[model samples]
Target: MNRRRRQWALKKNLLRAAVLSFAVSCASNAAFADDEHRGRDDDHSGRHPKVEHVLLVSFDGLHEQDVARCIASNACPNIALLAKAGTTYTNAHTPGLSDSFPGLAALVTGGTPKTAGLFYDVSYDRTLYAPSDTSCTGLQGWNVVFDETTGIDAMNGGALTHLDGGGGFNPQAIPHAKIDGVCKPVYPHDYLKTNTVFEVIKQKLPGARTAWADKHAWGYDWLNGPSGRGVDDLMRTEINSTDPATGTDYTDVYSHTEKFDDLHVQAIINQIDGKDSKGDATVGVPTLLGTNFQTLSVAQKAPVAKGGGYLDASFTPGPQVSAAIGYLDTSLGRMVAELKQRGLYRSTAIIVTSKHGQSPADHTKLVKNGDTLSKLLESNNYFDASGNFGQANTKSGSLNDGTGLTGTGFIQTDDVGLVWLRDQKQLAAAVKTLKDNLSCNAPGICADGPGAYILYGAPLRARFGNPAEGRTPDIIVQPNPGVIYTTSTKKDAEHGGNAPDDNHLGLVVFVPGAPGAGERVRDRVETTQVAPTILQMLGLAPKLLKAVVSEGTQPLPGCEERRF
Candidate 1:
């Protein structure tokens, strides 16, 4: 055949494939919906077929590209195994800000920062009073710093000595909010504006046991939702706490982070064995249980010289990262093996995704601004005379001491700059200052530089939310892809940004004995959908989740369609 004829034939074949795929997807969805209706009619119960347990796992900093590369190279055997039996959403992404708070909130709450009221882990809340001022008196814009330091140690000068997050959040570190004219301290759970999947599951399935494990004992408390009792067993393994063996934090080394993650892994195994997270109590296996692995996140942040981070923009893993992925795969295999041993494999649904992906996967584009954005804002009179730029109440008696809220102006920067101006009237001035100084020659943020741009005024509000509401940042500066606004030389990349490398996530929904093995869904989906999907799997109403109702979240496409 001639060249043009051959090209025409190829195009025709491609169109045929596309049409076939669409038809199959529609048929699958229709079949599952029919099955669901029948199940409800026959059983008189809301539960879906096949799945009795939902195991949600988050591999922080695991990008879609990482999963694709790993699976292609057979580096991540366990994930590959899940993908082979499940549908992998290759174009999945986080809903809003890539910060851990908002990212994780999106997954569990089925909402974005706009509805969840979560922007970053340590963010500014203009409606909240300082932690020290519980009476709802003077100076409202409180820098809400809910991290590892928010634990009980803060009451005694801040010491992260224990693994259980110093026995949970310190009352002293909690900000106060006036509700119904009564001033009350707001715990991490109260910070959320919407309910979580855990809360919905608990409400719908009264006997269902919910649990979760994460890095922070205090900051992650928000996962419990507004009720604070959503999760029946919330693990308190603090990753930032000092490890006696290494004399440093678990995040200081990739291998050390593996050791830290292993604790959660063991907790999961214990849960599978019909025990609590500690393996000491027989609390029964939780219906919804999972943990976030930080080893990959640590490896991505570590310097290249330390055998961490990616080798190039293609996301080929370096030594530390490769090992971290291997470890995660092995850990996942262990969970699958446990499920099989317990004869729960066919009845369980597994979800593998990430809170956020590390930015500047291409190391050659790294730009360390050394906190220059804060300095510029401070020098330009964006902050008070005391250099307090919305950040205050230093329980540790130092500025930006990394323990308590101790900065000026609510400025949090990683790969992007989230600025909540102390004075909203100065939004224009701040934007101009950033625009005027868009030069790489200066040791500050470059607005017009490569992959750099400013978001403020109506555009910023339209995308994020109305900044006037207090939680949203007045101005946002997404700098160059690799331009991290930090001075720390310990890491090469960071997350918490809108960059491609930061938001693009890996998402896989695996159910044993489910049809459509090795199917890949190229359709774009949000991580927020995971919440409602989980409810659907458990035969609960997704609308039971407040965010699902408000945000109009839908179940993942292949999830309900491919009935096990």
Candidate 2:
């Protein structure tokens, strides 16, 4: 695509933050709070004269249902107490497909995936335009993975220095090869064509001390990091060299959950102490924090690591839910108590939220290659595991309309499959046959699940359609829910869909005396609005927190927009 088209696409996805009036009902149990009219907190900071400090925490995948259910069960009291103190939006949400990339983009950029150019783990960059089969190879720059799946990665880069290899790239030691992918994402913060909230903050409050921490790569999105889009401190290091002081020991020893829990708790404690061994809160400086948290990252056919399981929607319960609720609660309680002890609880504002939610692991509901669909296709000869689809009985016939296509292969599994054909012309024929034979079966294959609509032709083109692109796969097949491309049996739950439970996630704001916080607010809320809201609390101008492109409208007053 050309620059003109890309610009148009970008405009279409810009996120706008506005007070929305919506129905009072939601899947979450908490009721919506009435919007309060505007009021004033004219008090100035010691010097800044407006907003003094800000903290944002981005947990992995917590849904609105999870919040309500956990709250009722007392699985999370720290967050629950905040709900009672602040305005908790039952309707708070991420973009429809709450995948990580888009979810985090919404969190920091206030832009949708389409607008932010974010897709799944490996997405086709339309602007750069690479084919799907080159194994997505050939890059002008390194593909940066901004993740913090392991505590070691959090403290040091992906180096396992805490154990061996000096905390550098040591995928071999990882329990699973997939864990290597847990490395941080390559954020285009430096390449960002637009400004972010942090840029605005520095422009306004130059003296403020800002910080951030997370298991993910974009921890300090405030400054966006070394690349300099916007961000200050990120807990990571280079590809080689590692020592314990660099933070290699933490992730190397503990799980993502435990490591994050420990890090944040300790950070809170440091702030409370108010001394840097020099014994001076005013003399030197101490206790500055940024958003932080942890969770399982890699996804297999099944869940492993702990807190890994299939998400059965808001109504469905899973053992992992209880474990997650318990761990997160303990962590939050530690944070709050630390604040009170430090005497900063009354003046501090805590914003708690997650990047996305999870989908329960349920294979029975999935429709992949090993299922009845593939069997019927194979028997009918419409599908061939050996890629001999139109010429098995007789090799004389042309495979790609007489193109004499030579290279082809096929990978199959119960959930999804990968078919690489040599002839582009054969794509249409194969698709038609599959729909007529496989989808027409008792269970329709095309719906909202994995196999819903095929992301083929021009949609899959360029990245999939480019004639010269080496990465272009002959074919990319999508499976319905439960159906995955991987043969791993451990993956019972997943995401990457347009499901409500998947789209809606967990969110909490903890502070004393926040109105309607204990319950839910039915009014429509969004992640992009988070930055703006936080800036508002600090008494900063909307633009500083919202960023130049932010679409958030100012809240009415004490009460936000009214919900159900």
Candidate 3:
């Protein structure tokens, strides 16, 4: 965690009266969150008006401005009202590289990518040795043992057959679950080794209830991976075969986004309205409730305007900000209404956040700069068939044409550039050629030898061992800030780096009645602190959840109380 920053969790003294009111008002329903508080007495426990529940909601690509911006644009009134009743982080951020893998890992586990060995979806693992072969059939690089059916796959269907069959997406090659002796599909939750904040709550808050809901791939990243450390029930889009038994949807990925948010809302809404699936518990306050909406595509503060439903291109706010903010507002409105109806609205802790921010997929200045890096590779014969070739694990990989040579193309992932060479013995020659040709390429890259450089590469054997685990890369190239790859397909927004816009996401906390509840805090807080904070609020030991927190890999810091 970042230590050079200001204290983030300064306890507010003014919360006493509010806390007292909370206890009296919610004593009938929520109690110790989970089994961790079994021996504790609700009445005599020193902590007064303690948190009964915590609801964490994560939007896929919402920036802080989505609240304020869409509000001013009149696209999201519900979310704007939420800000009015809570604190908003104008400068909240994610890890350096804003890729989904590390970003979400930092948020839930409070651990950095470096610790989780999650620098990127495809990173360099130093343990296993990769075979020298580079082909489309080579599916050993990523550290994850299983194929996680995140939002991407969920949105498409309940199965990841397409991604896995493509060779490049196969999880069978990963050594962790490599049952070449006997093939067995690994579940999504099996990939994470760290305990999440939820796990802590389960340990400390014996009776308190906890839950989560969020975007596609991101939801699974937390629901089944690191964040699952403590949650009792969850609503996400992960397609794990074992999910059904655990109260998760085993095959509901094809539902609409509104249904996505609504599924959670309806579940909690039913609880708030005082009716369980079996009609057991009466309408009562829950220990926790959470769900997310796509603020990037809808207004977060307004009522759905007839057919104008925000997504209509004819709508105002130029269709971009309107849809995102509007949808966020709609989701919030529904949730708040449900709380208001339950009469337990006074004691709920509601947290709102975005998985990441947005960036122009095709920024003007970025385009010109990317060209410089391209030229450097071309000049170095890096793209030349005689020099570089592909035998990757997909249709895009090189074909082994007898001489151990393949295609002469490149693999552009997130913002990192990967290069494959025909011969391992030619690595030294390639490095020299790149440096010699680098200055001419200029804008897009830096030599990466010493300080302040961007381009870095080495033998897969030297950097990370096995290519089968998807950890090894022959050459690693990071682009200059703001620059992205300009392939045939184009996009208006993109994210996958440590840049400010990419790393800095939005954060909102809305506990029902804490004294600091409605105050907007501009203090910078890292996502890693979230995991510890969850444990702290629930009176759980942070040590138990440390494996999930990002210490060095992310810019987030450990949670600190106000000393003064």
Measured against the true structure, the TM-scores of the candidates, in listed sequence, are: 0.88, 0.60, 0.62
Question: Which parts of model 2 are misplaced by more than 4 Å?
Answer: 1-51, 126-188, 191-193, 216-229, 237-256, 271-288, 296-317, 361-479, 510-514, 517-519, 544-564
| Top of the candidates by TM-score | 1
Give per-model CA RMSD.
10.0, 12.9, 11.3
lDDT of 1 by residue, 1-564 (tens): 699999999999887765433111211111123333443222233332356788999999999999999999999888887887678899999975798988999899889888898988878877887667667875677788788867776455556788887785776668888999999999899999999999888888868899899998887888889998999999988898888887888988888899999998999999999999999999888899999999999999999877879898899999988999999999999997787677666567889999999988888988786777777887888865455453344546643233344224578888888998868888889888888877655745755655578888888776678988888898888887788888788999999988889999999887644467678889999999898888877767678888888778887877643321
* Model 2: per-residue Cα lDDT at residue 257: 40
What Cα-based lDDT does every candidate model obtain?
A: 0.80, 0.44, 0.46
Name the better of 2 and 3 by TM-score: 3
For every model shown, the clashing-pair count is 5, 78, 76
lDDT of 1 at 183: 91
lDDT, candidate 2, 1-564, per-residue tens: 689998977765552222322211111212111211111322223221222344566666676776787778877776776676655667777754455655766665555543344444332221231111123233321112223322233332233333222333222111111113332322334323345555556556656444444443332232362236354434332222233455543333224345445655565455445432212343212223454454322221225344344444333344554565567677777766665555455456666777776543332454333344444445445445444522121233411111111233222332333343434466777667556643434433333443345445676543324422422333444445554433344555456554444566677664333334355567677676665555555545555433324444443233233332
Give the Cα error of residue 511 in candidate 3, in Å: 2.9
Model 3, 205-280: lDDT tens per residue? 6665555544443324434454434554454333232232334433222123344455556766765665542235
